[model samples]
Target: MTAGPDRPLVVLVHGAWHRPSTWDAARSALAALGYETRVVALPSAGRDPAPTASMYDDAAVIRKELDQVDGPAVVVAHSYAGIPTSEGLTGATNVAHLIYLAAYLLDDGESMYSRHGMDVPADTTGLFPLMGSPGEALYHDVPRDVAARAVEDLVDQSLLSFTGTVTRAAWHDIPSTYVVCDDDRTIPPALQETMAAHATATRRWPGGHSPFLADPQRFAALVDDIIRSR
Candidate 1:
């Protein structure tokens, strides 16, 4: 299928502790469907020689990518990615739409830690503490092999990223759709629903946190449908 006027470039932003490769399957599926896509490598995610980048740095990277897009683009932000994506897309005219896949949608001056009613933890080793048993929390619904690989591919997220609050909420101006993974074990579904209230639209999916990993083709189709319906 040819990309229509309404079909914008798809930019995939992975969540914390995840690299760009996490969207490999979904990116391939989108490509097969004739959709051009870009996956962001979050500097705050996993940095060699330890990470020093914060959420602001991550947002700058996203802004740089959006600046390069000549036409309209749709940004898909997953989990923690939503934080930087929201901050990054502020006043970005090229962004046609935003899809938050089981992600947080913080408002201006709010942060992940603040949203949860917790104080920002002190930066330890310049990274956030990795969750225990990620395979169970993130990929319980995924295939055994895929789940294993996903766990192995997980990396340290910069604590500064989470501590940094959003300066602007892109969702306030951009039309956005929030996809809530109803069965997500990482972020509570209730919290997902709560955050979904901030979006232009919301969708609920019966899966774990990483739907793209569990079923990439189906997830890509869902993304396509959402973009088209908009």
Candidate 2:
């Protein structure tokens, strides 16, 4: 879909261990709705050899993308992307709304590891291992072949991305919505609810973690509704 001036551009932010290409389907769907979309490639993901960029670095990348936009934009952050998205969108006037899709909605000084009930590593220079079966955990509702490909494309995430804390919580200043994926295996539904308290509103969706992969068109429609309503 071509760029349109009628609506805000949608910016998609991917989670840890995933590439910006993961938003391809979601972007296409949003484009069909006459919305232009941009995907942010985090410096913390898909790094060479050992991962070095932290979530703060990822936040800078996101902020740079937002700074280049000529008009308003809405950020749709998925999973770990929420951490940087929260920090990055701070003081970003062009971002009109934030959508946390089965993603974390943490406050200032909160790290991903600490929110997950895990201890922050003293040494964050190393790579954080991908835990459990990502295919089942992240894409259980997606097709077998697509999920397999997604798992194959996964990379080592930086330890600091998870251990690092956000200095600013954009959701507090920006109107935000949180979508809780009930069947999510990666981030439990109960925990999602707990974090969602900081959002302007909360919604529950019946699916696993990666709903965009499960149903791109529907996901895009939901995003459209949220953006338009704001």
Candidate 3:
């Protein structure tokens, strides 16, 4: 866990109803801060006709990305993406740290659908869901124009991603950080606090569920500070 001058690659996992492009601003900002970045295009949200992708599918893709990296990497999971990221980082030797940003931090055998003991959003039948516009699901504090662009790019999410359980939780082994968006609408801050207990370090921000979209420069600085403090 010692800090190293060589910046590790920062791999970003966007939540449900999102694409890898969601991390565009953060990727640019991180690069400016001297950190290489990669974005994961989760398979669960893909355009395939059959219901194929699950949490394991997404996690396997992430593990492949981790295996390909030559040096240590930091994996940051946003919202629902945490499920896949956590399960994916279980045996990733190249991962130096794991970061959860207002994300679902599920224990082993736990599915996103059962989080807080809530009912699953859809039936067992394959379903694709859309994200809420602007303030409803995220980006309440962001400029309207910015939020609009984000909403316009939303993707349909597979219900399978929610039902699949994680076989492993990366936070148990890797040095981990959790960033709680205090005003998050998607994942309540109270639940986020409950999950924060497992992280090596925890931070709070007054942003919405999608804080990186609200202000990537500030979010990037916060992530940079985290790496420095470690």
**Which RMSD values do the candidates have, in order?**
2.0, 1.9, 2.6
List where candidate 3 sits over 4 angstroms from the true fold: 1-5, 47-50, 119-123, 131-134
Poorest 10 consecutive residues by lDDT, candidate 2: 1-10
Candidate 2: list runs displaced more than 4 Å: 1-6, 47-50
lDDT of 3 by residue, 1-230 (tens): 22234687888998887889989998988889988888888888854524767778889988887777877788899988888998988877778888899988888888876776877655654755664454577878887998888888876676777788778898888999999999887788999998888899999998799878889999999988888787
Residues 1-230, candidate 1: write the lDDT tens digits: 12245668999999989999999999999988779998888888874514668888899999998888888899999999999999999999888899999999998899998999998765434678788888999999999999999899888887778887999899999999999998999999999999999999998789999999999999989999989888
Colliding pairs, model 1: none
Clashing pairs in 3: none
lDDT of each: 0.89, 0.87, 0.83
Which one is best on TM-score? 1
Q: Each model's TM-score?
A: 0.95, 0.95, 0.92
Supply candidate 3's per-residue lDDT for 196. 87
> Which residue pairs show collisions in model 2?
none
Query: 1 or 3, which is superior by lDDT?
Result: 1
